[model samples]
Target: MRFLETDEHDDPILSVVNLVDLFLVVIAVLMIVIVSNPLNPFSDKSVVVIENPGQADMRMLVKDGEELREYESSGEIGEGEGIKAGVAYRLADGRMVYVPEAPAGGASGGAASADGAAQ
Candidate 1:
């Protein structure tokens, strides 16, 4: 009779142990996921990182109204004044696709001449 009573009480303790084990497993999995997430606080900023990648050189420029900005391969950003808004992207194939700006008149004409001479 005494042994039967002890076994009955052991069931409650065993249940508690199983519950703790289950929670431990859950916490471990959550920690793994947090560490592996790309947006985790410990991760680096999400910028284009080029490894020993191919020679696919590219250039991107952004403009806001009359202001133009250039982004270089060495990660240098430059700003300059321009006419109408436009964006220029130089692809790896050596093709420069740019948005048309406002009609040229004064400074633009000289700039165009200089650019053509340089090429």
Candidate 2:
């Protein structure tokens, strides 16, 4: 009966149990912060995050669907092998207009002007 009546404060394991509880609370808070982040991986929305913009060590994170792509700058002007697909112009009203080039050997198409109107 004396063993069962031992003081709880005198137990050596009590301190360890408290420490474990503190760590569990800390981990829970961290998990909540990660889940609430806008760029969380579990999120379905696509996002683009640029780090160290315009610097030599610049990096870009592009998240599309479930795929995440990382791009690091090489400290040089980037050159890509691709043809121009369209032209964008700023109208007097500060609206952007995009004019897509017609495919080769195809009839000229009307300019799909801004505001979803055909010109």
Candidate 3:
């Protein structure tokens, strides 16, 4: 504690203090980079998802401005005018399934016609 000066300029402690300050600045910069990264877990873009992976089993048909029909898993997809109805699904065991043909008349009439046709 002598007054005003001894030659303390050669001390090793000053270099160590400078090294500690540099490390503090590097850690602060790294924290800012981590917070700003686009792929961070809290980012908004990570939330939305898509569920389906393959062709859909159902569809809707629209004609003019009208929704003309809805289709289902029964292989009954609607055919547009030039398009003929075709067999659609093959099961995993290799059997083909097709939409059933519409009855020529109502059910009772079709039954009677079938009996007549068989005779």
Candidate 3's C-alpha runs over 4 A off are 1-5, 42-119
Predicted candidate 3 versus true structure: per-residue lDDT over 7-108, tens digit per residue: 667678988998999999999998889877544444444322222323465443323222233334445566666544333455577655454334457342
Worst 10 residues of 1 by lDDT: 109-118
Best by TM-score: 2
Q: Which of candidates 1 and 2 reaches a greater lDDT?
A: 2
Compared with the true structure, all predictions reach lDDT values of 0.56, 0.89, 0.50
Candidate 1 TM-score, true structure as reference: 0.35
The TM-score measured for candidate 2 stands at: 0.56
User: Tens-digit lDDT track for model 1 on 11-119?
Assistant: 7888899899999999999999998754455654453333333343555444434444555465446688856665565757776655445565734322222134322
| TM-score winner, 1 or 2 | 2
Point to the candidate with the largest lDDT.
2
Sort by TM-score, top down from the best: 2, 1, 3
